[model samples]
Target: MEYYSVDASGYSVKPRGVALPRSVGDVADVVRWAAQNRTPVTARGAGTGLAGGALGDGIILDTSRMDRVRYLDGVVSAGPGARLGAVARLLSGYGRILGPNPSVGPYCSVGGMVATNASGSLSLGYGSIIDNLESVTLVDGRGDVVELPSNRHYSDIISGICRRAGPFPDTTKNSCGYRLDAVPSPDMSHRVVAASEGTLGVVVGARLRTHPAPRRRALAVMRYADARSAAADCPRILECGPVSLEVVGPGIMEGYGGSCVLFAEFHDSVPERGGPDHADRVCGDVRRAAGVRPVMIREGIDRWLAGRNAALSRSLGMTGDRAPSIIEDATVPLERLPDLFDVIRELGERTGSTPVYYGHAGSGNIHVRTPADSRVTEWYLCEVMALGGTITGEHGDGMGRTGFVRRQYGEQNHMLFGLLKDAFDPHHILNPGKILPA
Candidate 1:
């Protein structure tokens, strides 16, 4: 029970009980019991989510024990319990790789990735997990086991609600509520469930498309005097065709205080590298990205990569429980990224919270964690929505941002979300109080 509560984001909810099912049949049995008893069911994976998607007060469905992997030609069939890193290791033997590799690293579960539509630094080159998803097998709220796309009956049921759905966001990634866009398209049943966060059903298995891993790789580091400078140059950097382009405060890298740095990597080979006229830059490997400073190549480079992944953890640690707002991971259009940076800085001044910023710049997905009040989240969401961005880029809306779903998509679209929730889980017995406004 201790392990069943709280996610990495520091949000905790004591569940009534936990159910660790060994097979899909067991999962269905538990969900059926919950449905009949009017109890909530929360599906969980590796618990690596930055949002509190896995925390709830009812029956916690733990799938970590269902870890299993199988090969399936162009795609791979994985139990919702399968560890993503383990799956990646297996695929590497076949010269393949999972498309959406979250910076949360290899320890996250496959189900969790699909659950949150996980995207990482490399997502700039590849899309989120939703983009690579092929199909899914799940147990509906009533405990009926079902497979998607292959299960046209369930698809038709979901499609009916989607045909009357409202507008969808124009952003690159969205994990706030039920994915209605996936409906209306018969083949997109998996996409709809992939990011639903278990509101619709309990995931049993998933089929994911794999791609050839890059044989050669190089990382480039460019230093800008400030975030604005780095943000201003992001557009030109994207033109270079690097696999990823990210921005981090100097604090993440070693001994660099008050400096803004951009880390870009190329998968095939090092592209022609250049930045601002006075930009002190390196574009060979990790160390070269640091202007070939006196840091050790292998060790320094490894630390640099680790630092980027640790951005969320670092900000969380800095809060010391005093920060009012833990808001992170928002996506705007590429052209508006510079303006986004300016707004965050202003937001920081207004809130009296230091915003630790970092993320995939090419796609305009950045994480900003500050210690402000709920108003900060509201202001940020309103601002991003005004710019045609999303409240979350990779992290799903759990306890943190679910209340803003209505304003994020407006009343009509928000109502459609409720309709889809009923379409899949009429009793609202699965993952209740998540992705839905009270």
Candidate 2:
């Protein structure tokens, strides 16, 4: 029970029962039973979610047993129980890759990625789950089996409700309350379900779009004296088309001879025989190229990438008692990267909490760790929203950011989310009190 109670966020909730379903039919039976008894059902993956999306007070549906990966045309269909690493390994054999990857990597589950619209370092060139998802199979709160995209009647019904939603934030990544605005004219259920955080239904399986693996790649490490200057130069650097552009804060990268360093990579369609590759210029910052130590080998690449993935867990450990602060995953538009860095600095000064800044620089999604109260962090959120940003990106508005979603999307959108909620789970027993008011 303790194992099911907590997630990476440090948030905990005791579920009534833990169900390990081995098949889709078992999952459906559990959902139906929960629906009949008026008990909430929370679909859990590897429990690697940082926002407490999988922790709730009812039934915990552990999808680990049903993990299976199958290839179908341009997409890979997998059970929600499938681990992200297993899917990646399966696709590696075919020279294909999942478009949106969570930095959590192997620990994250396919269902959890879809549940949070997860993205990673290369999300700039690829996209979030909203773009790569093909379809999903789910069991709503009411115990009804539903396959979105295949069920047009309910799709139109939910679309009618979602039509009244408010405008979305003007940023690259968002995982706030019910992204109704993402639903297309004909209603793309897969997109709507991606960031809903299990409020609408329990994800059983998903078909995700895949991309062909790049033939050759080059990586360059760019150092900047000032963090903001490093961010400001991102626009020009992006012009050079780096498939992956990620920032590393001070102390995060040692002996790099700078306060901050950016990892940039470019890919080629075919293997390089010899001569100059796309990573030659370092975005024309020739002085920066003096430290052009590239990660041409597998060991260096894996070691450095490990540091990037460990940011969140490391921050949580370093913060002591003030570990689980709310100033996390504040994403702004690429043009406003400088502004975000400035705001994070101000937040550190005001709250007296250590601020760590690093993320998908190309997408302006910076993860800030400030040891402050949620109420105090609201100030940063307002500033980002004013600059056309999102309060939470990739990390869903679970226990941490649920209170701020109202202001992020306006009250109209919240009302629409309620209407759509009724269409799927009338009893509100599916992941109750998540992405919505309790």
Candidate 3:
């Protein structure tokens, strides 16, 4: 119980007990027991979530024992406890890979990734979990094992919710509240679980779409005077067909010898003879579009991406007194990125906190590291909402952001979310107090 108290988010709340279920039947049994006892059940994965999504004060259902992976046709079906790294290793032998790669790397679980709709730098090209998911199997609050897309009742209920739901943030990725907007129809209702944060059901297994690995890759590191300039040019750089575009703020650029740096990576899936040359040509086009020459260009595979993925950990190691802030995963439209930077600048001016920014710039999602003050966080989130941005992009609205879900989505949408929750978890025992009040 003590071990399940904290996660990468640094927030602690000791659970009453930790339940390790070895199979989907065991999971259903535990959920059933919890519901009958009127105790909350929180489904946990690798416990590497940056938000407080995996933490709860009631029963902590650890799914690590359910690690299983199988491939059929073009989709990979993985158990809730299966680690992303393990799945990737298995898929690599088949020359395929899952699209949404979270920075936590192999340590994060497939279930956690789906729960948060996780996305990495590659999301700029491949899309998020919600986009790649094919189907899902989960145990609802009633202790019933349900396979989505096959459950017509569940699908119709979600489709009704989607029809009545309001518009979501127009961003590349979003993980704020119930992703009702993702369910275009009853057939695609399984997408509603992508970022539901386990309030609706406990994920047992998921079938995800995989992509062919690129034959060649190239990375170009560009330096800019500030994040604003780099962000202002992202829309243009995006035109070069690069697979990923990431930015590092000054706080993390000390070792790179620059104020801000952007990493643009282009991939060649075709095994043509001129793959390297093609990458070079695209790199040159990217440089021309940005109107700046790259500081360094690495052809083929390299470790440059490892550094970018480690930016969050490095920034946290250096935050002496102020821990990593909760107002980190705000994402806006690509065209509104410069305005997002303006908000960060104004936040610094008003609070005297030097915010660190680094994340998927192409998707307009920038992770911020600043002092965690209630008033400052509120003001910053308000500004983000004003700019048509979501409070969280990849990290789900766990305990950390659940209180603000109603504010992010207005009363009508929030009510729709509650209705969806009721339809799935009639007893309200599955991860209570997550997307809605317990």
Candidate 4:
């Protein structure tokens, strides 16, 4: 119970108890028991979530025991508890890979990834979990096992919600509130659960789309005087057609001897037969788009990406007294990224707190680390919204940002989200006090 009280977010809430479910049936049983007792059931994976979505005051359904991976037809079907790293390794054997590889890939679980719509450096090319999800099997609030697409009744309901739901921020990736925009129709209704944060249903299993491994890859590391200049150039760099465009803030750039650095990686699919010349051409295009020469260029991947992948950990390590703010994952329109940096600069001056920024620049998503101040967080979030950005991008609206969901989406969409929650979990037994405010 004590161990179940906290996750990677550093937020803690002691759960009533933890149940290790080995199968979908076991999960259903635990959910049924929770429903009968009128207790909240928060579905948990490896507990690697940074938003504290897995912590609860009621039952904690640990899905780690349900880990299972299978290749069916053409897609990979994985139990919600399956470790992402293990699944990726398995797919590598078949010359395939999962798209949304978060930095916490080695420790995060498949279900957790789906819950947060987890996206990583590769997401610029492969998209997020919502884009790659084929189908989902979950236990709704009523303790009924429901599989999307197969359950037309629920699918129609989701489609109806989609119609009434408000528009989302015009960004590359979003994991805030219910992903109403992603569920365009009944066939794609499963997408709604990609970032629901377990308030809608407890995912038991999921089928994900896989892509063939890139046969050729190139990486270029570019340095800028500040994040704003690097952000200002993201749009042009994106036009050069790179698989991933990542940025490291000055805080994390200390090791690399730069104030701000952008990593642009291009991949060539096996069928394209791209070779050294292709990599050189892409690098040259990226260099021209950047309007400057690169600090380093490599033909292979991972060598330069190692630093970008460790940005979060490095930022955390550097923060001595200042804490990572709840308003970390703000993502604005690509064109407004420079403005976003300007706002951050103003915020730091106004609050007198040093801010660290990093994340998927191609998507206009920037992760900020600053002091824990409610007033500062609210001001920054309001500014982010004013810039047509989401309060959260890849990180879901868990306990940290649940209070701001209505502000992020407005009263109309917040009400619609409530209706959607009712449609799935009428009793509010699934991860109560999460995405929606009580």
- Between candidates 3 and 4, the one scoring higher on lDDT is 3
The residue-by-residue lDDT of candidate 1 on 1-438, one tens digit each, is 887877787688899999999999999899899989999999999898887999999999989999999877869889999998889889989988877888878789988888888988877677788888888988888899888888888777677767877777777777877777756577677688867888888889999988777655556666777887777777776765666788887565566677887877656422343333212233323333233232222224446778778777776776557745575788888888888888898888888766788888888888887777777778877888787888888898877878878887888778778877887787899888878953
Candidate 4 local lDDT, residue 312: 79
Could you tell me every candidate's TM-score relative to the true structure? 0.90, 0.92, 0.97, 0.96
Clashing pairs in 3: none
lDDT of 2 by residue, 1-438 (tens): 999999887698998899999988898899888888888888898988878989998899999998999986869999998988999999998998887878878878989999999998878667899889888988887777789877887788767766776688778788888877787664485578988888888888999998888765666667778778888878876766666788877765557544787877665532332225444443344234333333432125657777777766665665657654653787888888898888888888888865866788888888877677766777888898888898888889888888888888887887888888888888888888788876
Stretches of candidate 4 exceeding 4 Å from the true structure? 270-276, 323-327
Greater-lDDT candidate between 1 and 2: 2
Please give, for residues 290-384, the per-residue lDDT of candidate 3 as tens digits.
95787546543446778788788777765655654654799999999999999999888876767767999999999988776778788888898
Top candidate when judged by lDDT against the true structure: 3
Candidate models: Cα lDDT each: 0.78, 0.79, 0.87, 0.85
As for lDDT, the candidate ahead, 1 or 4, is 4
Off by over 4 Å in 1: 182-184, 269-303
Model 2's number of clashes is 0
Model 4 deviation from the true structure expressed as Cα RMSD, one decimal place: 1.6
Q: Positional deviation of 37 in candidate 2, in angstroms?
A: 1.4
Model 2 TM-score relative to the real fold? 0.92
